[model samples]
Target: MEYAIALVVLAAVVLVIVVRPLLGSAGEADRTAELRAELEAAKEAKYREIRDAELDFRTGKLSQEDFRRTDRELRTQAIEILRRLDELD
Candidate 1:
């Protein structure tokens, strides 16, 4: 009977040790905030590139064909980046 009581106590201690971390709330919020910031920065950079390309085209710095090609490329890149962000979420 005494050995059984000791065994139960030991089991209880081991259980607590193994389960404490699982019981606590993990740092999910911090990770989400970091991911959101990264997404926001990427979106801003993508838009900035598009705007710069448009301005250059308007100023006659790029021909119409070149502008259309660059516009397509930038839009495709932006879409891919957004798709990756969706996957992360």
Candidate 2:
């Protein structure tokens, strides 16, 4: 009877060790989805900002140099956001 109990305990421990990682992976999936959504939203916002900056430059509101600098920065940031989204996918 004591040996049986020991065997059962060992089985339970093994089961937990195996199953815990599967459960942990599910949680990670949820977090990944949430973060991907956030990144996509940020990317859209950056694109919009870039468009607005372009309009401002065209309307003589921003100097050519300032516009180019801001647009380049926005493009770089947008690319990084997209890369992150791709990684999640």
Candidate 3:
């Protein structure tokens, strides 16, 4: 009887050990999806910022050189983030 109980206990432990990682993978998927969403949002925000800067330039709020510099920098950063997001998927 004691051996049977020990065997059952051992099985339960082993079962838990094996199943824990499988359950944890669901959380990993959720985290990946969340990261992807954030990356997309950031990319969109960068685009919007670039658009706003262009509008500012057109309205004479920003100088030509400043607009070009700001647009270039923002585009580079957006490209890098997009590459990273592509890698994750």
TM-score of each: 0.66, 0.83, 0.90
lDDT of 2 by residue, 1-89 (tens): 99999999999999999999999999999999899889988999999999999999999999999999999999999999999888886
Candidate 2's TM-score: 0.83
lDDT of candidates 1 onward, in order: 0.90, 0.95, 0.94
Instruction: Estimate the Cα RMSD of every predicted model relative to the unseen true structure.
Output: 3.9, 1.7, 1.2
Ten residues in sequence with the least summed lDDT for candidate 2: 80-89
* Best-first order by lDDT: 2, 3, 1
In candidate 1, what residue range of length 10 has the lowest lDDT sum? 21-30
Give residue 89's lDDT in candidate 3 (0 to 100).
72
* Prediction 3 TM-score vs. true: 0.90
Error of 2 at 71 (Å): 0.7
Candidate achieving higher TM-score, 2 or 3: 3
Ranking by TM-score: 3, 2, 1
Give the clashing residue pairs of candidate 3, or none: none
Model 2 per-residue lDDT at 59: 97
Instruction: Residues 1-89, candidate 3: write the lDDT tens digits.
Output: 99999999999999999999999999999999999999999999999998999999999999999999998999999899899898997
Q: What's the distance in Å from true for residue 50, model 3?
A: 0.9
